[model samples]
Target: MTISSAHPETEPKWWKEATVYQIYPASFKDSNNDGWGDMKGIASKLEYIKDLGADAIWISPFYDSPQDDMGYDIANYEKVWPTYGTNEDCFALIDKTHKLGMKFITDLVINHCSSEHEWFKESRSSKTNPKRDWFFWRAPKGYDADGAPIPPNNWRSYFGGSAWTFDETTNEFYLRLFCSTQPDLNWENEDCRKAIYESAVGYWLDHGVDGFRIDVGSLYSKVVGLPDAPVIDKNTKWQASDAFTMNGPRIHEFHQEMNKFMRDRVKDGREIMTVGEMQHASDETKKLYTSASRHELSELFNFSHTDVELPSSAKTWSHLN
Candidate 1:
């Protein structure tokens, strides 16, 4: 049996025809005796990647961070983490990868940022701060039985416990989907969206990054009002349903906005590819997100298979069939 492209008129980009290699920079290789892998190490190993038949290389986050989430929690969008080398090293890596005819992909994490970020710091400083709306901040749902303020909603954190954290200074609750240091961005705010686009996406693309592996892309646009999630189990801690958070109401709208930005910058022969890390989304949502007409993304990273696990008794030594 043979398979063919349904649309032969359209030429497939390098991404569609190429094999991708994902490398977590911290563990890939260490050029210096610095314990952590750096971009210089990656640049030095270009031949190895090329010989491995990888057409593109996607490196995990190496942005300036506190390393709370191992580079996922970004503090400075454009600056490189000092331990991973200077910003010049990163630029050189991109050049080296392109020189080898390999596309360079960087991880784009826009969903949430580290609390140490200037924007977050300003947002959390006071309720009257102009950047306060950049992140999701809301009043409590009134005092509990013991007079303690409850979270705005029953939504639980992705890591664990309540998603909303109370701020004594601001006298309000701020939503953090992941670790306390990683506060979810408010996509509803146009200013916030514009700032993020100009920095995270535009900054990298302008510097010649071939593409992006967007992290937690599906959790960008959450439902309005922050409604309570239905209880899945009485004994369990996390009560929120991903239905409202995973693929929110304006998800496509947000992606389309990003698509337009990318389209305007794309040259005639040079095309950029985007792959979103979509979690807990339905089949229809995935289809819409990756559809060509929708102008959202080129592909998606489906994590359904990651849920597979082995029994505790078989943990000693399990082999794939």
Candidate 2:
């Protein structure tokens, strides 16, 4: 059996034909030998990557974070993690990669950020604070017999616990789809999305990154009304949140908005590329994500069969439904 292009007349994107090299900066190379990799180390090896016939370099997150979840829990979107190197070092790496004729793609982890991030801090500061709406927060459903506050729903953290973490200061629970240290951002807030696009997406593009590898891309949208995930795992108090959070109601709208914002910043003579790490979305739904007319994504990494997060009983498509 063989497969052919359904749209042979469509223009081929550069990334479609280019070979890519994925780098985890923390352990890739350590220029200063602080026991961790830095931007300078990656920069030093640009020619080596090019020599290997890689047309693009995809670096994992090196953004400012508490490192609770490696760099996935971004603390500051605009700053580089100090051990990784300074902002100057990052810019130089991007410039060096471009001079070598290789595209640079950095991780964009917007689904959730570190609890220590300024946004999350301010959000958890007080319930009435202006930024409180920047993350998902819900009042306790009720108190249990032991007087402990129950989470708003039975959603489980990807790391294996309650998805909602109680905040004593605010008397509310904030959602953390991953770890308690990583608070999911509220994409429903237009202000938050605008600021994120400008600072996180636009700044990198302006400084010379060719594109981004969006992390947990399909989980951007939140399930409306904070519904409980189906109790697929009978033994656990919490269940997988994919049913509510993945490929959410506003997923396409949010992606299109971000895609347009990214495209509008293009200065001509330069083509921007993007690939999203997606999960729990159907093949038909993925078509909407990469459709040029839809302006959602250039490409997407589907985590269906490739995802090791699912249990054996839950791995089948029937279980997902």
Candidate 3:
């Protein structure tokens, strides 16, 4: 896809001309006719995708999960979901994809992990646990007249409820911007971030993964103080949270750290692509996110144009007139 430049000093990157086809493993192609697609099933259709003019395949989350939030809530980043096949099948698919001259990319759902995840399990087990700080657990704002505890804030989850979910064992609440089953990871903890990198990013990159489509990258770093969002709709206590969540202060810094790690892992000049998925970011923010000089990301998925269908007020994502 590269064109003739007036200056002859142009070097083209693989992704610049790559046509990536996204695959949802659940229904993409079925090999065993089990009514569900597996990693091998996707591997079987590589030639078809390549012939259709695709240079790369970006597969959605097939990580071990509890099938909550359509597998966006990952329980184990290192293991392939049993429904989608085993780890061997995933590795074989990666190898086959590379052999077919097509790059393989996988969705990185690092914004949150399944509540069933061991990290989350340990985090919620006790307030004194070493991993307790790995997640955003907050004390109740206060107790009501009846002595029932109130949530830390009025922030709304994207799935239409309070973002904070209470735990009976810990007597505290944990933040989940999306489904309650997906507890948001606290990237503020350097140890937590390192563990995530080892188990998720480093593990995959060490394998043959060519890139990652980072889910909800803009919401990675929330406002430090965890302030309540401004109220929008009068009828609902839950408030829109774009002001505190979207484009957090250290987003670029975090991305740069990831980019640096990716670069450091490079062997023989291989370029690993990274595209952040953020629907609410402005064009200016996206520019910085993808700027080569910034060393942030290879690209960014933004919905500045397609957001017209959304309401002007800071509401959770939904189709609206």
Best-fitting candidate, scored by lDDT: 3
lDDT of 2: 0.86
Global Cα RMSD, each model: 4.5, 4.0, 2.4
Using lDDT as the yardstick, the better of models 1 and 2 is 2
Backbone clashes in candidate 1 total: 0
lDDT by residue for model 2 (1-321), tens: 122355877676678778889999989989998999999999998899888889999999999988988888899989999999999999989888888878899889898889999888899999898889989999999999999999999998877789999999978999998889999999999999998899889888889888898888988888779898777878888888787888999999999999889889878657788898776678899999999889999998765765578674355221011
| Angstrom error at residue 301, model 2 | 1.1
- Supply the TM-score for candidate 1: 0.91
Candidate 1 lDDT over residue span 1-321, tens digit each: 122466876556667777888888898989998899999998989999999988989999999999988998999999999999999999999989988988999999899999889999999999899999999999988997898998888877767789988888788899998878889999999999999998998888888898998898888988888888887657655565476787888999999999888878666456788998886567888899988888999999766664558432122110010
* Candidate 2 runs further than 4 Å off: 1-7, 307-321
Residue pairs in candidate 2 whose N, alpha carbon or C atoms collide under 3 angstroms: none
Name the better of 1 and 2 by TM-score. 2
Best by TM-score: 3
Kindly give the stretch of ten consecutive residues in candidate 1 with the minimal lDDT sum. Answer: 312-321
lDDT of 3 by residue, 188-289 (tens): 999998888888898999888999988888888889989989878777899878788889988888899988988887675778989878777767888899
Ranking by lDDT: 3, 2, 1
